[model samples]
Target chain A: MGLLKKRKREGGEIPTASMADIAFLLLIFFLVTTTIDVDTGIGMVLPPKLEDDVEPPPIKERNVLKILVNETGQVLVEDQPSAIRLIRDEVKKHVLNEGVDPRYSEAPGKALVSIKTARQTPYDAYVGVLDEVWMAYFDMWDSEARRLGFPDYATYSAAVAEQGAENQIRDKIKAAISIAEPDKQ
Target chain B: MASSHFKKKTSVKQEIPTASLPDIIFMLLIFFMVTTVLRETTVQVRTTLPQAEALTKIDQKRLVSYIYIGPKKLDGNRLGETGVQIDDALVEDMGSVRTIMYRKLIEQPKLIVSLKVDQTSEMGIVLDVQQELREAGALRINYSSKREIPS
Candidate 1:
């Protein structure tokens, strides 16, 4: 009977006086140490590395849209000195070549927009050339999307918002821009 | 009309309980501590990545290996000298990139080598780095640049 009888418990609570202080300390620590960096870039998938150079089958010259950026930052579209701003329109026209010029690409699929930059070319110049090429593809996609009834087809966010024919539009607009190995001057 | 309520009022002083405040705060603190990931490496050399209108974000940070190309921070000795930084270390010869990155490729097979190059730097250095990277078989590359919001 005595063993079965338990002592009376005392009312006690956890010491939370310092809880807010501790929380504030931690919040401050994180606030001070946090680095919310927004990182986004141009993604490129490079072909596998080769041990030795190999010869390839010959292809017709009509499909090639050769763009050359020399060491002195001279950008030439099909061996002609082209202004930076001209690259987008020139690339677009060449890619969708309506047979305007005999040297431009015949079709988008057969068209190869090859970018070759010299060793001494400035990074800005090189990226500028690549950006213009990318812009050409983006513009083509935009115009095509606009034709499909999406009037505001400027950025990817605009396309993602629309409900109909997403995959169809995306597949048709996806253009492959091949970057050749850099030529050492 | 409120006489009964007034009559029932106690003389004991009432105090707000704050003992549980720390626990709530601690829980929040722990949540933050667990979720926070320190990814940005302490950059040694000065780098100014070029801006581009089109960009894509790499969701997974683990798959990326940064190759920083820029002039070393001006400290009198290294003024006007452009150097290559792989990860966090400053590498000297361009030839070493292949070997260095090759080991990284072995560790992470699908490594995305992001080139965070300065706009003013010569393309020669970048090309050399790319040549080495190709030889190293670290193919999946990303050109790291800030978003160029039109003026």
Candidate 2:
């Protein structure tokens, strides 16, 4: 009778000995498939489509700094042949002139940096010129941030961001960069 | 008596407690699962991005749409003509870029088009694509580039 009762009684609990193996399998699969790389790059905003009937606003010749990159990868700052290394200083002087120079901008807020590239210009060359221009603006912003009692521009911007305050530096020193279209090939 | 007590202590079996093994594995699995992106698209073009110093990171990845412009990769380590790739397909006609981008803009108005162009490629194709993007009203763009190693 005892032997029969023992045979009738089944195992009290379901098997969990294989759970660790199953979890290990899933962990291995996920570990093999994970990718942690982040995408980084330069950001820009393109102007919207212009209607045929709308006329473009006119910017003064003196306030606009013309930068041209030709097919040979040569850079021309204000129609004068220049090297890529000189663009940053030239851009800074032009933007920060504050009416001291006759050929430079009237004010930082009104200054315009126009970049025009040829159809055959290498993409890297164009990017190099653009990077210099942006670096000039960043330098100006940093000085402005320091004048306003901050260690650097990034810190000022971050502090302002945390407080939900308007960025006065950006408003005062606007980066008014315009990308001009190249002539048709 | 001391010898008997020492023998009694040595008689007990020693084994590692592994009852929490599944929980530990599950934690690791969750971590990997959260970070995984599952390798979606197979890029057909070779985008050797240009290097630059002025760079900004796009934090919101969901708002990004990629446009790859580079030489078409062919068989046996050869590169063909310059091609434009959107998603997994290569765009044959340049004019269709406007329509395709316009449709994308309709779905996500804040779509930021990330242009991944090869370093040696000319500006002609890049501008053409920009023109198409302007027409499509997807104005926000990112020029994908590597950070310049400071010399």
User: Best TM-score goes to which candidate?
Assistant: 2
The DockQ of each candidate is: 0.59, 0.75
The most accurate candidate by lDDT is 2
TM-score of 1: 0.79
- The 0-to-1 C-alpha lDDT of every candidate, in the order given, reads 0.77, 0.92
Q: Who wins the DockQ comparison?
A: 2
Per-residue alpha-carbon lDDT of candidate 2 for residues A22-140, written as tens digits (9 for 90 to 100): 99999999888876667788888999999999998888999999999999899999999999989999999999999999999999999999999998899999999999998899999
Question: Among all windows of ten consecutive residues in candidate 2 chain B, which has the lowest summed lDDT?
Answer: B34-43
- In model 1, the Cα lDDT at residue A49 comes to 62
Clashing pairs in 2: none
Clashes of 1: 3
lDDT of 1 by residue, A11-105 (tens): 44565567688688987787666655646888876656654677554656877778888777788888888877899998888777756678887
Q: In candidate 1, what are the lDDT values of residues B1-151, reduced to their tens digit? A: 5886776675566788876777777787777676566665767677788889768788777788999988888667564678899877889888899999999999999899999998888877887788799889998898898898799
